[model samples]
Target: MPAINAIAADKLVRLLGTPRSPAMIDIRNDAEFDAEPRLIPGAVRRAFTSIPDWAPDFGDASVIVVCNDGGAAGHGAAAWLRQAGADADVLDGGVIGWVGSGHPLLDTAAVPPRDAAGRTLWVTRARPKVDRIACPWLIRRFVDPHAMFLFVPAPEVAGVAARMGATPFDIEDAAVRWTHDGELCTFDVMVEGFGLGAVDGLARLAAIVRGADTGRPNLVPEAAGLLAISLGLSRMYPDDLEQLDAGIAVYDALYRWCRDATDETHDWTSHKPAKSRVRA
Candidate 1:
């Protein structure tokens, strides 16, 4: 049994990509981190000794601390965070447990460098439709919650990425790692590249995104609906960022439905056969 103020690896895995997920603080030292460059999805590296100072940065959100093992560092950081008046917990067995449970961890070393403000910067063609929006949703929810995206002209993507130290994605180029690969859309590429593909819910959403983006709405029944909503959203907001803000809600709903209600069905009436109550 785990100690008080500690969360089991399986429980944390179930909460990984949801909004209810705690603020994940990776407190592993340099040697511990070098042993495995990948990180728990959406986790940020922070010095365990500095918890008393930076713990408040998390505000009211619950925090989870992790180390190479759940021995001293994780417990110490959680204790400090609790002393700072925040709800904190230690990963029961740390990253080793998370990994041992077969949960996907993001490969941080493969991502682009962060800006001085400590945010991953990305650039893509403006006026996004499907893959573009979906990729950002995945990034924000599972990679960097504070990641910055630059929507620019299609012709300037390479230039802006080069000059601004931003990772260019969803663009047709050899250097971009988050673009299409044959039959897959950029959303599919991101889901696979970021280790998100293993999540069944995300995989379901990726299939829908792929169907809409690849001009094959027949791939999934929901693809046509997604395309329609995406087009309407593009027309509703002239500003790219505003459109993205609105789109995020739509995707959030879809993701939850994919996770929890995919098997549900809807009909005009709850009646069956002779029990029909609402007009035929």
Candidate 2:
């Protein structure tokens, strides 16, 4: 049986990128982390020695601490968090266990340098319709929960990225690594690049995003509806961030549908079932 304070590696995997996922803290030592520089999706790295300084930031929120092998580092950090009044747990097998379980670990190398406050900053073309919003949604949900974005004119994307230390995406440039690859849109590349290709729902959503963003709504049945909604949203909020705040909820719903309700259908006939069946 699993310990009351420990969450199994596989069990944690299912909640890795969801909105209700517990705060994930990676407490691997410097040497261990140097050997493996990746991080589990949505996990933030923190020092075990600095737990006291950071633990308070958790503020009674549930946290799951991970280490290289689920040994002293993870358990110790989780314990410290619990002592601070947070509902904290350790990952049973840690990062190694997650890798051994065949779950994807994000390649930290692809992530841009975080700001002083520890948030990945990115720049892209302004007036986003589909790819821009989808990419940020993916980042906030899976890569960095506190990521920031800057929207600028199309011609200014690269210049802003250079001056502001932001990673540029979805633009025409040989150096921009996050742009489209052949038929795949930026969202698809990110999903694949961040090691989330194996996630069935994200892959499905990526296809729809790709289809909608690239002007090929016929590629997926959901693409047309997504495009229509995205267009409407673009008109609703001229301010990019305001649009994004509203757009997040849209993607959140679409992702849930992709993950949990893909086969579900609703029609007037179902609600108007025969009286005998309705009673039962």
Candidate 3:
């Protein structure tokens, strides 16, 4: 049985990629981190000794504290966070337990530098359609929940990235590291770059994104539908940010479908009486 105020690794995996997942704070010491520099997807590193300073940043968001062994450091930091009025729990077995469960860990080296507020800032072409929207959704949901995006004119992407200290993505510049690679879209590159390719549904989602963004919707039936929705969204909002905000929900549903509903099928006949249903 798990300890009080502790969550098991298996249970945590179920919540990791979803919007309802708790804020994950890695409290592992520097030595422990340097030894194995990977993180649970979406977890942000925080110094356990500085818990008093950062605990309040979580506000009322539920949090799960992680350490090297799901030991004292995790429990202590969680306790401090709770004392600060944030709902907090310790990971039952910490990073070791999570790895033991065969879950994928994010590569910390792939993460870009954060700004003063600890949020990754990205600049991309304005009036984004498919890949642009999908890439941001993946980053926010799996990499940095508080990541910020700046949509600017195509010609200004590199300049804005330099001036604003934002990473430029989904552009054709030879210097940009987050753009397309061969046949894959930016979303595919990010999933692989972040070590998220092995996560349950991301590979399938990446294929759909690649297909839709590359005008080869035949790659997956869902790709065509995604393209249609993305184009419609692009037309719906004159403001790029507004379109991105709306596109977030679209990808959320697609991801859920990829993760949990791929095997399931739906039709009006599914609810119809067996006797009344048409026999093909």
TM-score of each: 0.91, 0.92, 0.96
lDDT tens per residue, model 1, 183-233: 999888888787777775998999899999999999999999999999999
Instruction: Report lDDT (Cα) of residue 162, candidate 2.
Output: 91
Task: Give the poorly placed runs of model 1, Cα more than 4 Å off.
Answer: 268-280
- Candidate 2, 177: how far from true, in Å? 1.2
Hey, what RMSD does candidate 2 come out at?
2.4
Number of clashes recorded per candidate: 0, 0, 0
lDDT of each: 0.86, 0.88, 0.92
Error of 2 at 235 (Å): 0.9
- Candidate 1, poorest ten consecutive residues by summed lDDT: 271-280
* Candidate with maximal TM-score: 3
Q: Per-residue CA lDDT of candidate 2, range 99-215, in tens?
A: 898877777887889998889999999999999999999998889999999999999998999999999999978778899988889999999888777764898999899999999
Q: Quote the lDDT for 59 in model 3.
A: 85
TM-score of 1: 0.91
Candidate 1, residue 150: lDDT: 96
Q: How would the candidate models be sorted by lDDT, starting from the highest?
A: 3, 2, 1
Provide the lDDT at 121 for model 3. Answer: 98
Question: Over the full model, what C-alpha lDDT does candidate 1 score relative to the true structure?
Answer: 0.86
